[model samples]
Target: MTRYILTTCLCLFAALAQAQMRWNQAYQQYINQYKDLAIEQMLKYNIPASITLAQGLFESRAGLSVLATKGNNHFGIKCHGWQGRAVYHDDDARNECFRAYRNAYESYEDHSRFLAGGQRYRKLFSLKVTDYKGWAHGLRAAGYATNPQYAKKLIEIIQLYKLHEFDKARKYDKFFARRSKDIAGKGGVLHQVFEFNNNYYVKARRGDTFRTIAAEVGISYRSLAKYNERNRKDILEEGEIIYLKKKRTKAPKSYKGRLHYVKPGESMYSIAQLYGIRLANLYKMNGLSPDYQIRVGDGLRLR
Candidate 1:
């Protein structure tokens, strides 16, 4: 009986060691795969790359957790006014709903925006980019995580992986500084444009006019309106999505057969903008009339 108990203890120890080795290997792979994205987020949002990576490692378990693997929810963000698909999982609460993404890159982008755009995390941006410790603690103080040792764990991960080095890279500083100037011209208007589904788009800010944006992007207002399926005389609203190229007839395969639940103040045009689909196609896909009124909680096909 004594010999059997000793053998069982040895087996358990070996198994635990092997699991640790696998976890370490996974963590290393995760860092290598996403370090560039983390750096990009840091340049764009002023968040520390180390803190982003450490939080990703902890929350997603190096992208191996069910929420990360199945839902592409790397940061474990919950559905707060989310207009897209969602998944439920037990996380601090049972069957909690988390935001789902089209891919891991989308998850990373959303995570950066989630922290940068939130009122609670505004103070974190005041800290130096290299101040990973302060950021880590500030995140905890802002109720980012429920764990008492959340800050300690983030610091430990940062130190162990030397993730802070990414933040101190001079090359990124020069690159982003030049990029920022080009994107945000005189008057602080963000004229930055990005491409998705082979279409170019710029987010509209307060006081942005199609004529102004057309001049900045060197595209005609007529062409811009045609591309976005809007009338040339339409007024641009703050935070509205303006496409510089034609939207796709169908959404990406990942969104096939997906239905969007209309929220308050969301129109068919807004829903098309959200999914990057052509406005006419959106109506056709759902067999709705051009003047169809979408009520709150109504289901609209997105594919």
Candidate 2:
């Protein structure tokens, strides 16, 4: 009898653990689906992609909620001052109005811009890409939600899935080009001649901005936006689709190879000598002040 009881208890414990793990996995998959939207927003507005993904996951519950599935509202944003269409739903016993979008990508883009252009989130823009935790907490402090533990919940989601890794800088010219080609093949944008992906997308791991992506893919930024049906003032979302026009890569005058960061104890003179860039050009590239204090991690353009 003792042995049987012990075996049953162990099985129950294992089952509970598995259930908890599955819950976490579901959240991760939700974020993965929309990560690109977060990355695009990060590049455009400096908001960490992790925070964006976490909030979306929390609000949408892995895209299983009716609001997300039917309305493309992954954020549960209230229609406080919105004049557009809306849908009312019951969450805490009372029905509330939620913003509606034409598609999921639109919601993601609007969310990013909402945060970027809003004065309430002004302090969040000053945070570093890696300081996702700070941003998460700051959002709570700024009354993003009524829940007192909102920030903690968001941080937990971000850490559990390693979502903040997207904020790290990376080079993805080829990937962006390929993605652009795929979107163009689908006939999404108005002008295929100059279209590029205009949809919001977050850097899943690390990636490029629309400007950098447009330049590398040989498409104009204006064309990229027009093709994707997005405006210059619109925000980019993670996993969001943008229009891409087919074009040949051009060797522009500003096409420098790749910039290298100056390490500790390294001077501008040594960097210039190593890269074969003139000292004056080096100074100009980095926007050096009269003191010329090149701290670590200062960006330098390489040709």
Candidate 3:
């Protein structure tokens, strides 16, 4: 009897551990399946990938909910002006109308368009794409959902699974692939491009001029300068960031609550270079004057 009791206890413990592990399995599967679509939407609409994924997870119950499975509505988007196929689901009201899609990808695309085209969600695009928390709060404030805890729940899901990392990773992968193709076609050395805050940049090499790099990369020199917030005539210094695209208004989510202590001889330009951020954006983020000088030991917010 004693042996049987001990065996039963061990089995129960193992079962509980398995159950705990499986608790998030569904969520993980949902992320893996739809992460690419979320990233695509982010690139196209400037929405945070983390916010998109969290909403999908919450509204669709990781695609296991009846609304998702039966209606193909991953975002719980209702039929406001939607003319596509739709289904009725019990939401805030019994048998509420929800927009349906032919497939999950259509649902994802519609969600992006829905947010981008809506006047109420326009302000969300101005926030940093990495700011999932801000987006969550903004969505709640914009009446995306009626739940008072909507923002909290989104933040909880984002933090629990570290979904913000996907935003940068996916962008990097796409940019890297495109850069590789460009290099391959030109039969030249692949210029190393680095990512920060979802922007792609390359270090200025010796004798690399803006016009020359622009010609090599197939972008206009004026556009490159505008993207980097620099004058076209500005001399390109070795190891300085030459952004291949526009910079974000803020830094990555991981940089929140973090400060960069200025070291001796570190200028604002140098600090921005260190983080691969645009100089103007760095200044804007900290509200520093154009002529502001950095002193040793001054704390600068990176996010």
In order of listing, the candidates' clash counts read: 0, 30, 0
Winner of 1 and 3 under lDDT: 1
Candidates by lDDT, descending order: 1, 3, 2
- Compute the lDDT of residue 210 as modeled in candidate 3: 82
As a whole number from 0 to 100, the lDDT of residue 105 in candidate 1 is 64
- In model 3, pairs of residues that clash are none
Runs in model 1 deviating more than 4 A are 1-23, 170-303
lDDT tens readout by residue for model 2, 169-233 = 45323443234223311111111222122223222112434664465345687776554444655
Pick the lDDT winner: 1
For candidate 2, the clash count comes to 30
lDDT of each: 0.79, 0.64, 0.78
> What does the lDDT read for residue 225 in candidate 2?
58
